[model samples]
Target: MLAKRALSIAGGLAVLGWPFAVWLALTYPELHILLPILALCFVLRLCALRGKTGALSRAFKGLALAGAVLCIASIWMREAQLLLWYPVVVNAVMLTLFGSSLFSRMTIVERLARWREGELPPEGVRYTRKVTQIWCFFFLFNGSVSLFTCLAGNIHWWTLWNGMVSYLLMGLLFACEWLVRQRVRRRYE
Candidate 1:
């Protein structure tokens, strides 16, 4: 498990590097293939880390594939400076908001899932719920503001669009999970 998690982290770092690599090699047209290939590796590694066996993973299969495609397709639209700054800004914001949570190993929502699955004892549930609320508010507030500012466009319109997509993606996944949980709860109740 530790090895799997470590590799996932390593793969994620490499994936994160793709944008910069794209930007750096922009003057060298032959290297255009690198970004998409890196994205493919990330998607593959993420799939491997997921074990390709869970129902949720299967349900999100299309989305995962689409994200990979989008990453590659989006790169085709980006040039040097903008491409490099894209993930740098987004991830920096995410990291600033969730640094402590990252330090704790699992994200707040991850722990919440553990509790929901009965993997966590009752004592941890309260903290998990509180942390989840904090993180969600951060996502909603800072994220929405970022999206709006992007729309106002002192920056590239693409960044704004990217922020909107991020918001939509998270919202879609949350809604899907909530719907599924609601159905399961109704069945049990």
Candidate 2:
């Protein structure tokens, strides 16, 4: 449990680091390298996998790696425009997904879903439902916003790709959450 908790924190940091690193690497150019980041990610994933179920930690680790690559790419390509505001996106994800963990009880679905392993249980059905809905809105907004930024031609490749991935992943999770809720409600009623 402690291990998983730490993994979540580290994962959280990495998530926050995404845009900052992307901007720094892009703007600072000659200073960044891909190998160390990849290696660190691999190590974190390995550590995270130990204390938690295979499914949960692995997904985050994957997200970290994918995110790191996108960041590195953005840096290589010199796209650092959104480095400052990227934390808003990170905060949104953290609050919606992780913040829910702090208040919620062990959600039956989350327990089964494997995404909530190291995190606290959801508070209740209402909390879970609301969080899911909020995430849906986030995805829809970010997905569209990132693409628009991409078109404006100032955004880094990293930001665009990361935004797309975030949007897609959140939308998928939201749909899955909605379906589970529907099934549960139908079954119970």
Q: What's the TM-score of each model vs. the native?
A: 0.43, 0.45
Model 2: lDDT to the true structure: 0.52
Candidate 2 has its poorest 10 consecutive residues by lDDT at 82-91
lDDT of 1 by residue, 1-189 (tens): 777777566556555454345444554667767667656765765665575654334433433444455556557676433343443344344544455454566655555478567565444444455555555565556556554644454344434334355557667767866775566556555
Number of the top lDDT candidate: 1
Indicate the residue-level lDDT of 108 in model 1: 50
CA displacement after TM-score superposition, residue 92 of candidate 2 (Å): 14
What local distance difference test score does each model get? 0.53, 0.52
